[model samples]
Target chain A: AQSVTQLDSQVPVFEEAPVELRCNYSSSVSVYLFWYVQYPNQGLQLLLKYLSGSTLVESINGFEAEFNKSQTSFHLRKPSVHISDTAEYFCAVTISGGYNKLIFGAGTRLAVHP
Target chain B: GAGVSQSPSNKVTEKGKDVELRCDPISGHTALYWYRQSLGQGLEFLIYFQGNSAPDKSGLPSDRFSAERTGGSVSTLTIQRTQQEDSAVYLCASSLLAANPLTNEQFFGPGTRLTVL
Candidate 1:
């Protein structure tokens, strides 16, 4: 079984500021990591994912996340955030073998202030 | 036709009533999934269906929650005798064949917000 933990429940940042959302997971075997974002009253959208190869993966919208095996962490980062970036973010993990199911974190609410 | 579509964007039901939520996955997506999101909480897996494989219902909170996918396309999640705790947004998602080694991106639906009173 795999589980994901997001340390921050709420993250507030000013426009154009850098922000990082921390996520950690525990699993016996290798797992896949993913980040999804949800805007107000909207469904979640895939931001980025770390399946294999490079430990660092990036999204087209200036969001990136690094997968750390040693630390068991996959933290999401953005160099500069815009007011429109305000939304709820989730970190999820799925085991490679066995049943394919995603274990999600509690989620982090990012409020970008203008 | 563009993305995963869900019916009844919002459902309001009374306690002890039964409610059903529907989902239409994207064409060609063989893997369908159901999840629930409580207020201020993360998504809880309910069931997963992949190409004639046995559906995985491990994450279902209780027997009150049940789901079924038909013809490898649409899926329905039902909550019998719904309780206050069942008041949450029911979401459905789908992806290509899980066995395929390519990037697995599960496209999500708008989700049905069920409010129990």
Candidate 2:
């Protein structure tokens, strides 16, 4: 079985400040990792993913996450955040195969204050 | 082009009542997924459908939950004997039919918020 953990339930930060959302996973087999964001009253939107290749992955919206194998972590980070960046972030995983369902973390709520 | 759409954006039901949610996936997409998000919680996978094939109902919480996809287009989720614990937003997502499936991105719908009193 595979599971994901997002330790921080809520994070508060000032605008233009850097922030990191921590994620850890426990899996018996290799899995694919993903981060998704959900704005207020909105559906989930994929932020970034680590399928394979480089440990570091980036999204177009200035969010990045690095896959750390030894630590079993995939943490999301942004050097600077805007108020608009405040949202609910989720970390998910799926078995390394075709069209499988994703197991998700409890989610982290990022609140950016102006 | 239209994205995924769901019906009855909000549903209110009594404890013993039943509720049915619908999802219309993106055109020509061959993969569909169902998930549940409880209040202030993350998503829980419920089921998945690929084409007309049988759906993967492994994540369903109980026998009270069932889903069906027809004509490889639309899908419906039915909850029998709903309880307060069943109250949550039901999400539907769809992806393209690819050989590897990893290359496809799953697009989501607004979700149906089911509230059981």
Candidate 3:
């Protein structure tokens, strides 16, 4: 079983400012981690994923997340955010095996203000 | 050049009525999933389908929720005796394979918004 917790419900940041969205997970077995972004009136779009081999993962949109095993965290970060980045972000986890199920966090609303 | 697609983009129905939402996954994808998103909330897992075998239905909230996939392609999610609480955006997703436990990336549909009045 896997559970994801997103530490913040809302984050307000000025355009071009650095930001981080914290996510933690509890799982007895190995898990895969993912970040998804949802724009207004749209469904979720995959941002990045941490599968294996590398502790750090990045998306083409200038966002990245590092998977820390000891810390049990997969926090998303961006060196500079844009107004277009204002959206709801969710962190999800899924255990390895048959009948894999995804557990998602409540989500963090990123408000990028110019 | 197609992605996951869902139908009845918006629906409004009276209480106690039943509704059916549809999903058409990407070509050749074998794994499909159903999820619900309420106002100001994240994705809620509902069900999972893999090939023609039995589905994983552990996440369904109640007996009123049921889903079926036909010919290993399209799917339909049915909600019975709809209640106000059932009003939400129903999302459908599919993966090339059952999310490789190591790295699962599920492609999502635009979603169907249901409103029970």
lDDT by candidate, in order shown: 0.89, 0.91, 0.90
Q: List TM-scores for all candidates, in order.
A: 0.96, 0.96, 0.96
TM-scores (chain A) of the candidates: 0.97, 0.98, 0.97
True contacts kept of each: 0.60, 0.56, 0.65
- Pairs that collide in candidate 2 are none
lDDT string for model 1 (A27-75, tens) is 9998989999999988999999888999999999999999999999999
Ranked by DockQ, the better of candidates 1 and 3 is: 1
Candidate 1 chain B: 10-residue stretch with minimal lDDT? B96-105
In model 1 chain A, the worst 10-residue window by lDDT is A94-103
Give the TM-score (vs. native) of candidate 2.
0.96
Q: State residue A9's C-alpha deviation in candidate 1, in Å.
A: 0.5
For model 1, give the TM-score of chain B. 0.92
Docking quality tier of model 2? medium
For model 1, residues B1-117, the per-residue Cα lDDT tens digits are 689999999999999999989999999899988888997666998888886454688878899988888888888888999998888888998988765436467899999999999
Predicted structure 2: lDDT: 0.91
Off by over 4 Å in 3: B99-103
